[model samples]
Each structure stands twice: as C-alpha cells, then as structure tokens.
Target: MNTTIIEHLACLEINNLILQPPFHLISNIQWNDKGLSFDGDIELYSSDIRKTDFIGRVPVQIKGTTTHKKQHKKSKIKHSVNKKDLEVYYKDGNGVLYFVVTINPNTHDRQAYYRSLAPLDLKGLLDKLEANGNDSITIPFKKLDNGHLERVCKTFIQVVEKQPKQYIEASNKMEFTDYTFNYADIQEDLFDPFEEPVYIYGVLENIEIPIETATLFEIRKKDNEVITIDHEEINVEYELKETKEVVSLIIENSLTCEFNKKKKTGKINLSSIRTLGSYLKCLKLIKYQLEHNKLPFKPFEVGAKINNKKDFKNVYDDIKMYEELIEICNKIGLRDNYVFNEGENLSSLFNGIIDIFKHKKYQLLNIGDNRKLENTMLYNLKLSDFITIKVMFVDNEFIDFFGEEILSKIGGLVPKKPINKTTAEWDPNNWEEIYFKASIYSNESIKELQKATNFSFENLKLSYTDQYHDIGIDMTINIALDFVNYFDESLDSRFMELALDLIQRYLRKFPDNDLGKINLYIIRFKQFNKLSEEEQEDILEILERAENENHKNICFACEVLLQNKLKARKLFSSLDIISQTTIKDFPIYRLYQNLG
Candidate 1:
C-alpha cells in the first residue's frame, strides 16, 4: 500500500475511535521521509508552508506526476513532511507523543512507510471519521496462506511496536508477544483482567480480598480553629497490639469547649476478634452432653461471654462440672493468670459476653443466618453465682429458646436480589451478553462453541485492534501514554472528545489544500516542547482541544457555586478572606494560604 494511503488510513481509524463514544483506538505508526524540499522552498510565506517546518510533522508531496513506474528512474527529490502528517501536539511543556505510521511495502525493503502523528486530537478525529462512516475498512487476515500470514504477522508486530508506553504499562503484566494464535494453545495465551488471587498464607494465586472495608479510614476536620484546639482529631490513628494474639484498637476523640473544668477521657473497646473465650464455651457444652450421656446436638459457639462474678459464686464450682474445659482452655493458649473483671457496669459485662459469643457462633453457621439467634441466645445462655443460683433458679428455668429452622432461614436472606431470568431473556440487548447458544448439543459442538465464544481475551484483541487494525489506536496511545496519562475511563472519554472536537474545528477552517491547522498544532506542541512539525496536523488540533476541555471540566467539578449572597458571604467570612474586594472577586482571583 502507498505510504500516503497508510497515513490517511491511520487518520481514519483515529477519527472512528473518537467519534464512536465508547470505543477507543490504539495505534502505533511512524511516517517515512520528509517531503521533497527545493532551495526555492526557503523564505516561503509563513502561511505558504516551509520545508524544514514540515520535516517530521506531516507528509506533504511536492505537486508533480510520475510516468512509467515499472521502468523506474531514480531522481533526487528532497522529501519533507507536510501539515497533514503532524497529527497531535501538547502545549504545556510535556514531552510530545508522535504517532509515526509505517507501512512496509516489501519485506526486502527495511525502510518502513512512516508518518509521525501528533499526540492525538481524539474528539476532533472521531467526529470527522464517524461523519465519514469510515470505520469498516477491510484488513486482509486469513491464516491459509503462509505468505499472507507472514505479512499480517509483520504488520501486527509493527502495530505493537507503535503502541505508546502507557498502554503497555496498564496492560496486565503477563506478556503476549510469544502467545500462539492457534485454538489449541488458547488457555496459555488467554489473559483475564478480572481473575482475583487466592491468599494461602498471604500468597495470592487466583483470588483477591476486597479492600472495601479494610483497616483504612477517612477523617475530616471542621476548621482551622477547631483543628488547632483538637489537633489529635485531625489525624486518625489505628494501633494493633501483639502482646498475645493480635488485637486491633480504634480510638476517636473530638474537642469540645465545655463549661466544666475537668478533662474526661472515655475509653471504648471497639471490638475483640480471635479471642480465647470462644474455646471455653465449646468445652463446657461438650462436657454437659457427656455427663448426661447424650450426643451433643451441636458444636458450642464461642462469641457468648461468661461472667465469673454474676455466673458463679466460686469459679471452681463451675470448673468442677466441666473439668475437661480446663484442658481445652489451656490447649488454646489461655493462661492461668487470664481474668476478665466485670465491674459495676452491668451492661458492659453483658455486652462483652454477647460480642464474644456471637463472633464464634456465627463462624460455625458460615453460610446461614445467625441473626435470628441473637435474641434467643441472649435469653437461653445464662450463668448465676452458686450462692445466688438457688434463688435465681427458683424464679427461672434455662433452655435454648430459638429453633434451628428459624435461625437457618434468617441467615439465608440475601441482601442483593437476583435478576429475573425471564425479564433478562426478553430484553434484546441482553443477547449481546450471551457467549454462544447453538442448539446442537454434541460434545464437539459444545467445545467449539465454548472455545470460539470466550471473551476472556477480548481486551487483548481490543488493544491489538486499536493499535494495529485501526489508525486511531496511534492517536489514542499518544494521549494515554505520552502526555497527560489518561489511565481511567473518565479521562479517556474527555480527552478523546476534546481532541475530536479540536480536529473538526481545524479542518473546517482549512481551504481544501491549505493545511495551516496542522502547522499551528505542531507549533503549539513545539511551544510546549512535544511534537515535531512532521506529524499529522489533524491529530495535533484534537489533542490540544481535549487537553483544554479536561482542565475546564476538572475546575467545574471541584468548584462550589455561590447559590445566594448569604451563603457566599458566610463562606467567605469563615474562609477568613483578608479583603472584601478579594471576596467580591473570589472567582476571578486566586488566593494563597500559609499553614505556618
């Protein structure tokens, strides 16, 4: 294919990705040769297009015709890039990303057909490409012929070479250059971005623990004065003590101006996990069953707490009933000196036992409802001092109040409702999500269907397609990897949109042959020290536009609007604005604050 055609094709692809809102293009391309530069081309009108300025920017052919190409006569023609080649440019002194589209017409000729593109005018390119409906280009890829496959592989490899640095970094680190395309070797090459890792002794393989509700916490302070008064509150701290088993403690403090003079510190034990109380309860229950010569109906739950003062007159009396409990406690590392003091705070003693018991019992019914047992367990699990037991036993009888069926049902309630299969099937869009649904149920057919339909490697294909199959990939990669790292979806969308818009705007201002926008973008890029003028102009315009829009949107989202004069006035006063004029011109002016 002609190198000019390749440059056009690259621009076309870039246009398609940007215009197609949800789709992204990744291209790796470089243009070859500067346009033919003549001595007379110098001192040309700045608007008339200069040769040196167009060297690396865009491909501009000096207008001339060739005849009898089969019998070639080599002539000295200085090749200089034109405005069309300078694709995208950056304005903020960031290193420029140039997409050079290279097409190797023959394997023998090592010199590739290259077009160094601008960073990316994503929004602008998309609008133009989509408007042209130039997305469905025929890329000849058939595996039957060795020669054809070789060319395809070469082109594909070239595409990979052109990818910007960022895309490669964001990709799952498992390299794919050596992966075989054959169906039998599918699993070896397949990449799954979603497969989490399993942590076996902190070694993760395929499952990952969610960090949604982890040890991390966020703290917010009211104002400078309050922050100064309660400096400790400004920084939230979490401490883990490993004196025995790990115990995590959380403490929160807020400063308040009080009329009273005394300073009071309230300590709250947030929680206790993996505690020793759990083992003791199970042992006691087992002993009770053994004494009665009855099969234990269920394992003991650990979360329930025991009160030595309230439950037993002498701890030895309870120990006498379950001598085996002493052995079980010692096996679990419960020391003889270990003692829980139940003070006058009756509620605290009860709450502590409940916390301990629930934690243990809940683990046993791992996948069931332990919630229903809360009230029943509270009433049924009881202890009394031997001296007071006779008096209390006269007034009360102990029994397990809640049934297993109720507890099981309560635990089974799932918070998230499942989607209705009937409704989902009825929707047309849902069919897009189906992998493969052929009615033929033979083993070979099923295997074929499964292998052919799996999308685990779809992302890899998308990345490859954007990089090599479509020209836009070059544009997308430039923005994503080269300049403002557009890693997330939001930034990608905005940048692409902005770039496409800028490109279209530039194109609209051009006279059919005059590629001035290309020059301006290159100049702008050079102003920020990024792109060479020899890149594609359309790409540069879009990149510049996308960057501007991104900045604007960020500012808009973070700024709070002054709805009314009163709120603004109060906020301004609270903000401690030094001058009324500064407050009045808040939006127009910038303020600097010193923490010292």
Candidate 2:
C-alpha cells in the first residue's frame, strides 16, 4: 500500500480502539478539502453499567504522519496542517486536535504515535510557524502505546468531571415569633447553570413587634429585569398577627430598593439602605417590647428611643445627632414634606429648622457658620443682627468681586461681648461695638458690607461717625496713615483714589486739625510741590502753627513732606530740649530720625 493508504489504515485502527467502552465516536462525515471535516466528536460515558450515561463531548481533528527519524537528536514527526484549519480549531472553544504518526508505514509492523492538543498547545505551534516563516506548522507527537493511550483517556474523563454541576439543591431552616410572619420566599430567574448552591432564610415580622434578625438581600439587573438565581422563585414573608399595615420589600436593582409600610413607601439607594434596614428592624423590636409589657431591654429599643427624640436640645447638643433622626425618617418611609418642629432650646430649634431646611432641599451658601442660620429668620431679625449674620455667609464670588482681604476678615469676626441678654433685651448700640471689632470703617470692609447689605458705602460712611463717635474718625485716619507709610509705585490706582478720598473727607470735616494735616502731608508728599499756590500756603500755615504750638511730631512730619532731611532732624533735636516727654512717645520722631 502507498503512504496515504497506510496512514488511512492506521487512523481506522485508532478510531476502532477509541470506540471500545467509555467513548462514542462518530465518523464517516465529509470534511473540507483539507481532509475530514473532523475525525469525530468523542462523547464520554460512564463505564460501570451497561446503560450508557453521557457526560460531555469533545470535538477533535486528526492528522496522520508516517516519516519518523531522529532530527536534531530527537525523534521527529512532521505533519503539515492548513493555517486556516489550525486557526479555526484554536478558536473553536469546544474543539481539540489529535496528531497521529505511524512509524515504518511500509512494513506491516507499523506503530502509531499521537498527541492530543491542549488549550495552550496552539501557542507553541504558532511560534513554530513564525520561527520557520512557513504557512503550515509541524507538531511533534509522542508514541501512542497502550499505557499512554489509557492515561490520555483517563485525563479526558477527569477534565469532564471537573466542570461545574448543571443543577443545585439548597435549603435553610429559620424560626420566628407568633406575632410575626414565619417565612420568606423569593423567586428569581437566573438563566445560567449553577456553579454553587444558594440558601436564603429570614423571618418577617410586623412593625408592632420588636425582633432582631440578620439577613442578606441583594438585587442585580440583567436584560432589564431583576435576576438572582436562575428563574427560581424566592419567597420571603414576615407574618404579623392582628396588624392592618401591609409591608412589602421591593427590589428594583443593585443600587435601588424600596420598603413600604401601609400607604408609605421610601426608595433607598445602596449607600443608605443598611442604616435604613437597621432602623426598621429596631422599630419592629420596639413594638414587640411594648406589646409584651417588657422593659424595652433590646439594644435597638434604646437606640430607637434615643434616635426618635422630637425635642431639639437632644439633637443639637451632639453634632452627629441629626444623622439618627434622618435614619428614623428613612426607616419610617417619611415623605419629603414631613415637618420637623422646633425644639425648646435655641440650639435645638436651630437644628430642627435645619432639618426642615434640608428636607426642603434649600441650598445655603456656606459663608462660614451662617449656614446654621435659616433663611426664614433672615427677614425677621433686626437690621444690625441681619447684617452681622449676612457677613458670615458671603460666597467666594462676592469676595472676588470686592477684591479685599479686610472684608473676609470682617466677615469672620465674632462679637467679643457675650450674648448674655435675651433677643428681646439686645441693645441696638451693641452692633457698633461689634462693627468696630470687625474693622467696619476700613474701606474694603465698607465696600463688602455695601455689597452684602445693599446699602451704599457712603451711607455706611455717614453712619460710622453717628454710631461710633471719635472711634470712627480714628479708624479712618489710622487707615489713611497706613496708606501713607506703605505707599508704593505699584499700588492700584483705584485704591490710591480711595485713600486720597478718605484723607480729604477727614480734612474737610476738620480742615486745620493737626492729625488731619499730618495725614495729608504724608499722603501728598510726592505731589506737595505740585499743589496749587493756595494749597501750598495753607499747608505752610498748618506747619507754622504746629511749630509755634510745640507740636514737634506734627512739625517733623510736615517738614519730612518737604523732602528736607536737615530740617526734619533739627526739629527732632529741638523737641528734645523743649518737650518734657521722650521722643519715643512720638512715632513720627523716630520716623524722621531714621530718615535723617
């Protein structure tokens, strides 16, 4: 026989051997031009009994090679397989390949050697193709003696046995009180085969009884429907004795769940569901304790009592108290319109109002602690109180618009005077003290106050003297003095104008005042020579009047404005002889001394 015929005879013999007991092979099917469509699909069966029990099927392709000789010091078996055929088998998912080689095909004493393709074996064959730059790859096969063939069959059986089971049986036992539901049944369809068993057990109770139980409930969406265990109906019920409220647990998806008690239902997202569930469980426990005339000894009962306080003092004394009330609301399925009443104390009342504010979804700009102030109180408060509180909540956008640090500093100011009096007893004049501490007279603070209060800066300026007396003038002159001392070429033009305006306003009020002239002299130092003749003469008269009056600091400050270092030094030396106080008492004395 020729080489092809000899190879065919060996394949037929091998095919007959595979059909003996545990394997059922289908052959005689037409393949493509490559040879046979597939050698056959081998179905594994249980061998202990006469009745055939199918386990799994492995689709396989077979190749035969006859030439066998030592190449590169090893037994070599060469067989050419089409590139397309190899690719199809590699990607088939259900397919495997067997390469068979029959040694000494020309002689009657031919022996068959074979190799079964494993999942990762294709990579090696592809590597061989790339290394040789060939369209087809040659695979090596081991001698397929009876012992090796038996091991291969045993391995195949083991692989089939290692797969996941097609069916699962699960059961759980649970007990509940007589007043509550005894069973829960949940049914869901999971179309995929079961890889492991699932068991769910829980006792449902009425809200009237208090009971503690732990349970796991999760929902996932698949193809637009909630799925859990392959189409299986899961039933869970908590029966309550003599209760008219109908409770239902509805699951929408992994992230969403709803609990309904009577006509009330609340949708809870994943993050808050655990707390909600715990609160509901506590409510049930509390009811049980009440019905039995017990001490309400359950931990959840104590927690429920603490969490369900209606008074504000209990909530505001602790920072995290609001979280407990929110949990109770969620557990009881409270509506969005649920009203929270004020507590007896102001702090509690504030927190109670905050609950309402949050329930209404009010967005308060966090200026500082002003978020603690309710919008309802804004219009009701006194104008001074309203303005003070309003400053605390200025947003960044308004701060950016005013462009001043003093405004932000003022906004953060708390009153140094204790709030010892009741709201009714508060004096309106107290706000002047508060505003003073807040540096309200500073131009930047004034600008920011104007923006917040809708009152003009000029109105604030006029009110400053009326409310604060000489303290307001001192604030204005001190700010002007800061501008003079720190004057630089890079100062903003608008800022310079504001400084000059402040100084001029003070001078207009007290034109010949020594402090006012000193501030003007310092501010107008660079422009002193450029002033109109009358302005220069007025300034000269103020300097002479101060000199004759022995006001050495004012005289020294005015002479420095003339850019006369010698005159400023001589005037300081003259002050040492005529003055009873030390030169250190006058800051201007030290300033001129340093300049000289």
Candidate 3:
C-alpha cells in the first residue's frame, strides 16, 4: 500500500478511540486542505444531560506514522513541525493536544503517543530552536499508555467548574457596601498603669445602623499556650432619625469586634485595622509587664524591658512587632502621616528614658538639688573637659532637652574671641594688649573669621596710623614667626602653610615696605622648602616683574630660599651695591657674596 493510504487508515482508528463514550469529537472540515493544522476539537461532557455548564474542550492535532525507533531499551517516536505552523497554533490562544499513532506492518498492532501544548510550551520550544540555531524542531514522545489523557480531562473539568463559584463570590463582594468609619473621630482615653482590662472608645459619627455595642480584646499567647486575656467593653447607644438611626460606640481599644449574647468576640489575629495609637498603648502595657517581672495572668514567662539594650533580643523583637503594626496601619487606609507622627513622639519618649539610664552610669550630671556643679556651667570649662561634657550629654540623651543654646555657648568658648574682629585698635605703646590681640590670630581663628565675615584673608582690611602702621606690622609678623616656630616644634605642616599665607597677603598689600619682609624672610624660607616645583616656577614669574630694588632684593632672596645654585649665582652677579640693612638681615647674604 502507498504511504498516504496507510497514514489515513491509522488516523481513522485514532478518531474512533476518541469518539468513545462521554467524549465528543468535532472534525475539522478543512483538515485535508489545511496542511499540518489541528485535526479536530474534543469535548467531554457531564454524565447528566440536564446540567448546562461548560465541561471542557481540547483542540487536537493527530499524526500517523508507521516508523518506530528503539533507544535505551525503550520504543519512542519523533515528529518534526515547522516554526511558522507552531507559532500560528499557539497564537490562537486555545491550547492544542497532539497524538501520534504507530502501527506494526505485519500484525497491524496500533500504539498511540499523546502530548499537550500550552502557549508557554510552544514558546519554550521556539526558544530551544533559536538556542540551537534552527528554524524547525523535532519533538519526541513516549507511548501514552499510563492513562495520562484521562487525567488531563479530569483537571480541565475541575478548573472550568471553579470559574462560576469564583464569579459569584466576586459579584457578591462588588455588591456589598462598607459603612463609613471616620478615623478622625476616634477618641482614646488614657488607662492607669495599675488598671486591668483597659477601657477605650472609638466615637463614631453619622451612624445609620442600630449598633448595640463595640468591643476590643487583647490576646496574649506563648508557644501556642494561652496567657493573660484582657478586653474592653464599650456601650453603644442609638437614636432614630427621619430616614436612619444614629449610633454612638465606645470600645476599649481601636480593634473592631462583634458582640452577641453580652459576650464580646473578635479574631485573635493581629490585623491591619489595629491603629498606631493602639499599638503604642500595647507597648506601654508590655513595659509595665517588664517592670513587674511577671505577666498579669499566671503560668507566663518573665518580661524584660523593651528599652533595655542588655536585653537586646527582646527589645529587637518588640521593635519588629511595632514595625509590623505600623505597616498594617499604613495598609488599611490609615494615613502614613499620622503613623509617622506617632512614631516620632514614641522615639523621643524612648530616647529620653534611655538617656536617664546612661547619665546614671556616667555620674556626669548631678541631678540632685544639693549638687556640687551646675549643668549650665559645663560650657565654660576647658576645651578637652568641655568636649568630654558634650559627649556625655549627647550619649546620655540630654542634648535635645537642654536645647541648642548650650551648644552655641560651648562653641563660643572653644575660641578665644569672636571671628568678626578684624583689627586690634589698641594704643601702639600698649604692648600687652597688642600681644593679646595677636595671640588670637591663628589658622582656626582666621578660617572662622573668613566664614563669619564672608571675606578672604587677603581682603581683610587693617587700618593703622603712620606710626602705628610699623608697630602693627611688626606685631603681625612676630605672630607669624611664633606660629612658624610652633609648626617646627609640633611638625604641623598646616601651621607653616597658614603662617606663610598670612605673611604673603601682608607683603602683597604693602610691597614697598621692606620691614615686614625682612622680619619674615627666615620663616618664609622655612615655608618655601615645602612648595612644589610648579609653585617655585609661579614665584619666579612673579619676581620677573620686579620694579624697585626692594622687590629685586626679594626676588634674589627667593632664589636663595629655593636653593637654586644657577639662579642665585646669576642674581648675585647682576646686583649693584646693596643696602646695609639687607646685607645684615638676609640669611643667605654670605652665600650671595661668595657667588659674586
């Protein structure tokens, strides 16, 4: 027989098997004309004909092949399908069921293999083909002898049957309307720490239903064992209106509950409807439990303080619980703004209590009335002592309570004088006052002054009379020389840089005056040794524009300061008769003479 005739006969036998009892097959009219498409749709129906619900329908593609291959002691069949046909079938949305029939030529025995194709399955097949660089792919199948088709039919029926029940539940939820509960109208009454079964109220406004009462419960459990149980009972009163009834409800806590037969009932689960305010109250109650070292009810474990870091495990657990409570409040339409506000207030209260404990440990703050030292006087102490006090205050959590004024006072005491002072307008003859004023001219003081006055060190204007000018210049130069010496003793590079910067600014302002430069040459030479090659080049450029002999002598002094043998030799040979003061004061005068 021809191959077409053999394949057609095999398909007929497969169709007969599908058309068995309880299964209905719809043949595709264009099956012969449409190449390699699905052969038919199979429908399974309920046993009762009166039932009018959708059972399930599966689209199938049937193939017949006489060829079979054995691999690894197992008989299997492989069939190839083009990529275009697979995409078309999958995009139709209805998944396909595939059946391959293999027949024995001599005995005419038939064996069937089946597989199902969902959209994702087909996409995965395409992905595999692309991964292996192929446009067509072959899918292998084992014999469908394990009742897999019956299982697929049963799963389809079960899934389709669930849709109607889901639809009805959704429709009912959509039809139901919730009563408006205003969070703003909620009122909380404080409970005494000693009280059992705390009472609170949620004042409801514009109520239309006849409400009898509202109630809240506190359920405590440990390892599935019940502990102490506390509850709040609220009295509800109602008044009739023209169209509806107005009701007022008072509940012990913010938790919503139902009442029946004078008994309050609610879910023991912590739910999202619990307000942030209620959680705070629970924290306080827990703290009380810790302080008493026992639960209100018997057969309970000891409670540890939630704020105690020594009991950090318990404290962390409490913090996590509160975080969950706050998260739930955010989830259930309680505005985050209110939750954050409550969180901040709780944090401040906790920090204040913790600080009290810390201060007790340090013994820094004398809280008693007959204390030897006052807390206010801590700002006026020495620098190191003041720093110690500040740290103690911050660690003990007293900083916020004392306000920022104390911090400002401490900052003022750190420096000798205010940074805004630009000039020491003392009598030139008053050496003590001049020395005291110059003592405050430090790197830190200059930086603070520049920050306060918004003026650079170079821009700071210092005024003096002709007689006082020399004296003021001498005092400033002396201060710079002292800072240089201090830098040498301390090996502090910043002090040297600062001294150099101050001297350079004064020199630039009064270039004609040689007194300041002469007094500062030794210190300048010390600073010059620290400059980079690029900085030395910049100084040489500045000196190239010298006009007066004082400026020329300063230039020659710079070469000597840099210790440049060639430049110093050339400058010394080019110099004329020098001033007596320059020869006497310049440190490198002997070296210059030897080069000449």
Candidate 4:
C-alpha cells in the first residue's frame, strides 16, 4: 500500500467508459497564505479534450488516506484506470479508450487522481449530473460549521436501541421480583432495515453514564426451587464521534447504490456504504436548497437566517410548493446576476428549469487583454468534485461509458441504466412522405439527420448552437452512409434502400476519413428475402469462389435485382426477388454436401 492519499482517491475515480462525459477536475488546492494554488496538482485534469478551462496550472495537496482497499500479491497486482489517466490520455470524446493500469497497492507508483475544482460554475456541473440520472443535489466538499450542520440535519430522525434487560423490583417493594421483556429482543426484532439510518452511532443518546457495566440474567424455575440458567457481565464503551439534537421526522425517501464489495475470500453486498451516505448528504443539501429558495451556491446566507426550528418550518413549508426553486437560483447565478432575496414567491420566477443546477457557462475571451471572469475564476478551483457529485445523478449514457472502460479497469463492474426513459421507433417514416429517414442519401435533411445519426442531439445543442441544424443534418447523412447499407428488411425496405443510396452518394461526394459502417441493415435485408433464379445463381457462384473481400457487394447485387423488377412494374413491391430463388452454395447447403 505504498500510495498517496490522493492516489487512493484517484483509484476511486471512474476510468473505462463507453460514453464518458468531458470532465474538468480542479485538483484539490494546497491552501497557504495565498488564496488558491494551481501548478501540475493531482486534482486538476480534464477527461474531455474540448473542455479547456483549467489547463496548465492547478493547485495540488497531499491528502490524508481514507478506508480504501489495496491488494498485496504480485499475482493480484492487476492494472486499473483512474479518472486522471482517462482525461490525460484521450484526445477524442467518442471511441473505445483503454489505459493500461492496475489498482494493486504496489501499482500506485503509476496512478493519479482528481484535484482542482471550479467553484461558481457548480450549476453547470449539477445539470450534467442530473442529465445522467442523478436525483441528488451537490455541495462543495468544504467544511460545514456546527450551526450549518445543525440547520441541515434539523429534520432527521434518531432511533435508539438499548441493551438487553435485567429485571428489578419496584422502588417501594424491594423484596418482590417483577419480570419485564428483554431489550435485545425488541431492539433487533422491531426495527425495520428499509428505513435510512441518519447516523449509526454506538453511543446512547439518553443514557446518563457514558461508561457503564450492564448484566443479563436468565432465570429458570425447577419445581419449587428457583435457579439462574445463564448470566453474563458486559462492559460498554461509547465514544460519541458526532451528536445533534433530536429533530424527530419521518423517512422521506431512500436510494440504493447497488454495488458488490469484495470480502476476505469472496464477494459480498456492502450495506449502507457508498450511495446511502452520499444520498443522505444529497438530501441534506436538497433540504437546505428547499428552505432558502436558493441553489447550493451561497448556502451561508440561508444558514444565517434560518437558525431556529420556527424558521426551518417556514422554509420547509415553502419548499413543498416551490420544489424546483433551487434550479431557478442556479439559472440566475449562472446566466444572469443573482442577488439574495428574502421575500415570498421565490419559486415562481423560473419555470423552464430542468437542469439549471448544472454549472455550464458561455465565456467570452478578450484577445488583447487576457482577464478571467470572476465567476469562472471562482469555479475553476472546485470543478472536479462538482463533476463527481453531479455524475452520480446524471443520465446513463456517460455512466455506461465509464463503467465499462474505467470501473471495470480494476475488475470492478457497476451496472447503470439511463436515467431518462428512451423510446425507439422501428419506422422512420409515415403516411404520405418519408420526411424522417435513415438511409444512404447524397444529402440528408435536418429532420433525417437528427432521426438517424448516432451523434448526441443534446451535445450538438450545447456546443454547436448556431450551425447545429445545418451541420447536424449534413453530418447525419454522412455518418449514416458510412454504414454499408442504410436499411435492412427489419426496417422499411424502401426507406432503407433510398436512404442508403442517397447517403452513399453524399459520402462519395463528401467523404472524410473514417470508413462507413458495415451496414447491418443491408446485410439483414439480404438474408431473409428470396432472390430471382438468375440472381440466386450469381450469389452461389460468388460463394463458391471465396474471392469477394466485402459481403456488401453481394447484398447490393440482391437489392438491385429487387429494385429493377419493381421499377419495370411501375410500383413499389414489398417482396424481393431473392425470396423466389434458393442458393445451392449457401453455408447450410455446403454443410449438407460435406455430410453427404
């Protein structure tokens, strides 16, 4: 375990991703007399090449180690990936990326972790997280004052379970013995596990003695003689790590992390470890946002105003109505100027606020005089933590990417589904005309571009707002034609064929570097349909030679025959001529010949 604390944290960061987001980590700062530090720090790294804010300079600090696992054996010294390596290595956002690494204790010599953070642009980070499927709200991982902690946890529930019982007679009747139910029976039996535990402290909240000895006795009566069946003396030591007032409240919600932990020998489910605590913290942040009618930024203002239970109640009540008020706060703070307001009707201001909590900002740079925006300057320090917190709450596209490439890098697998529901249409066209199509076309329309292309529409909206419509459409056609064929019989034949032809022509005219897709649709189209006797004979002849480098030509040859007959008939027929003929040299027929 010869690794730095920052190395351990780096190990905890995500690595192999099928669809990871562009990340900018503001490495942890070395806080000295100077306000903030930035210079090749472990914390500041960008996983995304497009994001170029915190590049050359970022503050770094040597952090204290937490309870992270380490491997010992050379055989077990497998390589794994952390967030920094993924950010530092990849030049493109899309594509399969692998960095050779390991999570073994001895392997820490080659590993790194996140550092710097962008402070004010938190809403952008929050939105990114929310986009991934995160229901959580984020706060900078800074120290919270006692008062602030108290204000946040004011509504949490505390349930105390006492030790087993020893019967004692009434104060007046000392001689008489009275039997009561044991404490252990009720404590273990009555408590429900589904309920969230706010803080699982061993200390007794109401018990007067911090250090005390307790005894348990089991009595047995044999005929007339009374005898003690069993007895044990137990000494209890309770150290209160943290404490808060009894703020009795109901369990509002619960979330599960759904990950496996490695035990001494095998795998075991870790209860209440990663997601539960983070979610509890998330809930607290959400509660704070609900009360002050503000986002996570400038939380101290709410702390100053709502100290007592009365103010807390008022804020809580207001939150039920304006549940999304924090989103508005984020929007104002990020886009326009945000000033603190204490009056009523705070939630009504921003209605179209789905991901206002994300900390994305459009920055204008000056060519002659280089000066940073105050907001950008403030956020540049905390960007990494902000992203980590938000990623937990975001949509599945990025999660799947990271889980497959990064988390699994250390032989760890975390299953994730898209946060938003995805609905797929088998057909891209309708009644009169095929406005939306996915085919090989020379020029693809804007609607067709969005409908067919694998490029993220949302990303296009964010990055290429001006030319997204025109570029996206052209790009879509280009990418679709890259596929060997546009449509399969699994899809609408006409749409697929026409789309493929148009897209192929477009590609031929404006071909870039990347080779087009193998066109699985076109491949599928050739497989199920019957071909004319003459066309079937040609396929058999080609199959006998094993000379064709591409199977696409065979598919093209088949589709062409079907189209020729349809054109001569002056009608679009659903049936392909390939369905009418059988190939003697098919793989199945070849296998039959070998058996014979």
Q: What TM-score do all the candidates reach, one by one?
A: 0.15, 0.25, 0.25, 0.18
lDDT of each: 0.26, 0.42, 0.44, 0.27
> Candidate 2: where is the Cα deviation over 4 Å?
1-426, 429-472, 527-529, 573-596
Once fitted onto the true fold, the runs of candidate 4 whose alpha carbons sit more than 4 angstroms away are 1-477, 481-596
- In model 3, the runs with Cα more than 4 Å from the true position are 22-36, 48-53, 68-76, 146-148, 154-596
lDDT at 323 for candidate 3? 58
Number of clashing residue pairs in every model? 89, 31, 2, 81
Residues 7-81 of candidate 3 have per-residue lDDT tens digits of 675576556665555443333423343555777666655553334644667777777666444321344457776
Rank the candidate models, highest lDDT first: 3, 2, 4, 1
Given candidate 4, what's the lDDT at residue 549? 51
Candidate achieving higher TM-score, 1 or 2: 2
Which residue pairs collide in model 3, if any?
A: 200-251, 200-252
lDDT of 2 by residue, 217-255 (tens): 333223222112224322222211111233222222112
Deviation in angstroms for 552 in model 2? 0.5
TM-score, prediction 2: 0.25
